[model samples]
Target chain A: MAERVRVRSMMPPGHVRTPAYLRGKVGEIERSLGAFPNPEELAYRQKATARPLYRVRFTMAEVWGAEAENPDDTLDAEIFAHWLIPLDD
Target chain B: MPHDHHDHDDFHHDGMSPSGHPYRADNDTPLTYWQVMEIAIRELLIDKGIATASEIAVQIDTMDARSPADGASVVARAWTDPDFKGRLLQDASAAARELGFDIGALRLIAVENTADIHNVVVCTLCSCYPRNLLGLPPDWYKTRAYRSRVVKEPRRVLAEFGLTLPLSTRVRVHDSTADMRYIVLPARPAGTESLSEEQLAALVTRDSMIGTGLPKSPA
Candidate 1:
């Protein structure tokens, strides 16, 4: 089974790279990209700690519910590992 | 064609702006805050020996040289060569570099369009485009309407661009929210089997790579 993860819904007002729309959304990991420097800290001129990145795939139905353009359609986005909370299947 | 020489009497006129617009601003039309900031930062950088004036000019020239044609050639090769296409799908940045485009730190992903699925690229967070491969993004791509509406109502938005996909074809939208950029590898138009790679490249329009339109069909 594919690993499940949820985007952490933390909304701090600063140089956040995670999109607010994807926050709180549950998605499946499409692929795990190797570690990269943190953009949030780098945006603040702070030392950027390397973190793993993952591309997550979410269905339109999962994102928009009844308002989904097409329930069968999908969306993908790259998220930092820090923003993702592993979900047990 | 550069009707854009600035008056050195008013301010230093290195003509660093790639837009080719004259930086000749009078008190009546003072330079914008960003223009002044860019000038200040660029001057400071040059003064501090961190970068040379000509190096900046050459960098701008390099950026200006990139266009959809670079991506078109890649697509044309992919259409003609299955092995290259496989490599492109697996690792886009390397594949683009194979064609001599110095994408420089751009993490690119090429999504293919097939009979079962269609892919579109957007950046709901901002205009996170594959500028390294496709040049600067279209102006409308940065508009709030496009960034907001496309993710939620892609079919409707794509229809506005005159693309009406069948329901059987699942629409997949990639939002380049962070760390990565996307390009749509559009399906080659039919009746183009006899066309040369260069000719095929000519048919791959910029909009097709963005997924707003399809590649030009043979006339």
Candidate 2:
């Protein structure tokens, strides 16, 4: 049987899900929401298993303008494991 | 209350009117032969039981009612209430649901706009959008060029639409991958402090939320 590659998110500076609007920015990892079979796979009827889901927390100024809002406010976005990759700290 | 027009096919008129216009003439744009084929695929899915007409109708109904009223309420509350805003950033779908909107099976993300940064969305692969909240996307939003190039060079693309952000402004591009989608919450424009929620919603244009245009104030 062919080895199945583990699905992961590559949120690099130049990846698809990592929007140009959020490059070189920083945010906190808020939660680990459950994931299901990847939609891209299911769109083609490709059989798959459940994956991982995450919600990345970012400040409005961190993603957009520094003057976006008060330091207290922030934004959270849910993403799949296939759309994220760990950055070297 | 009047029945939602898109709830049933009884109100879903597919044919051109006497003046060659669809019931909703505002979005009546000409489609090429290929676009017709694209729609056929969705119909095929329904026929095959992979999806259902009712499901698609629900999607349509979701679109019909997605006005700026909901978005404006979210933004205004975010500006005034710290906790509500926190929930918005933490989980947009739940936040929206708390405000009485049905996100239904649609996963969402909230993109907050600040003074110097902007966020824009495009479906580089397909027109994957949060149809439940934002309504059907405009034809221009689903174009091949816009899909292919928006992420690569957003500033230039936005400029073509007369959205020229200053050099100081940062632009973020989000590609709609999977069923996950995004909505832009533009910073409240100046000179609208005295407006009501309805008035604020009027200024919340679909284009602005998609990051193609800026929120406008009453002249």
Candidate 3:
């Protein structure tokens, strides 16, 4: 079974790799991109820890509700593991 | 290479630029805060003996030398060689390096444009692009309108570029939110089976690789 995840909707300020549009949206894991330096910490000149990243795919409808030009079309974005919350369902 | 010499030079179009937007005098414009910060950091790096002035010039030259031709050649080869295509799909950066392209640290994902699926690349936060592979992005690609509209209405945004997909065709938009960059491996145009590898490359336009348009028909 494919793993489903939801982007954390936290509103903390400062350098964030997670886009505002993708926050709180549910998507499926498209693929794991291996571990990379956490950009959020790297932006602040801090000793960044490596974090696993995944390409998450969300349907247009899931992102834009009924306003989606084509509900079936999809959007993919690289999200750090920390920004994603594993959904029990 | 004079110290006071402004960076703007050459390439004058009439009123409207090729992308249907007016050309901006951005090179001669006053430096923004970020630009000033960049100069400060670079000067500090140079002063600290971490890098040299000539090294920066050479780096700029190297980046300027990378053009769509390099990517077009990759696409052309992929269209012809199944083995290379497989490698390209598997690991785009490695595949590009295999072709003698020095794409340093660019984690690229090459999405294929099948008959029923179309792929587009954008950066919502900023203009993160596959610069090492395709050279500098067009001015439009860096604009707020493009960055915002692309992820929202990709089809409509593509239509402005004069590309219209069939009703059955699905569009996939890739937003470069982090380290990874993306490039579309545009499907080869039909009737090019007889064309040479070089000839096939000529059809791969910048927009085609960016997924805003399709490869040009044989001319």
Clashing pairs in 3: none
What range of 10 consecutive residues in model 3 chain B has the weakest lDDT sum? B4-13
How do the residues B90-200 of candidate 2 rate in per-residue lDDT, one tens digit apiece?
888888888888767777778888987788888776688777777778888899889866655577788899987776776666666545778888888898878776667
Name the best candidate (by TM-score): 3
- The interface RMSD for candidate 3 is 0.6
* Candidate achieving the largest DockQ: 3
Quote the lDDT for B62 in model 2.
Answer: 63
Please report, in order, the local distance difference test score of every candidate based on alpha carbons. Answer: 0.90, 0.68, 0.93
Query: Residue B13 lDDT in model 1?
Result: 52
Please give the lDDT score for candidate 2: 0.68
In the range B40-77, model 1's lDDT, one tens digit per residue, is 99999999999999999999988888899999999999
Tell me the spans in candidate 1 whose CA falls farther than 4 Å from its real position. Answer: B1-28
Categorize the docking of model 3.
high
**lDDT-better candidate, 1 vs 3:** 3
Best first by lDDT, ranked: 3, 1, 2
TM-score of each: 0.89, 0.63, 0.90
Per-model DockQ against the true two-chain complex? 0.79, 0.09, 0.84
Fnat values, candidates in order: 0.87, 0.04, 0.85
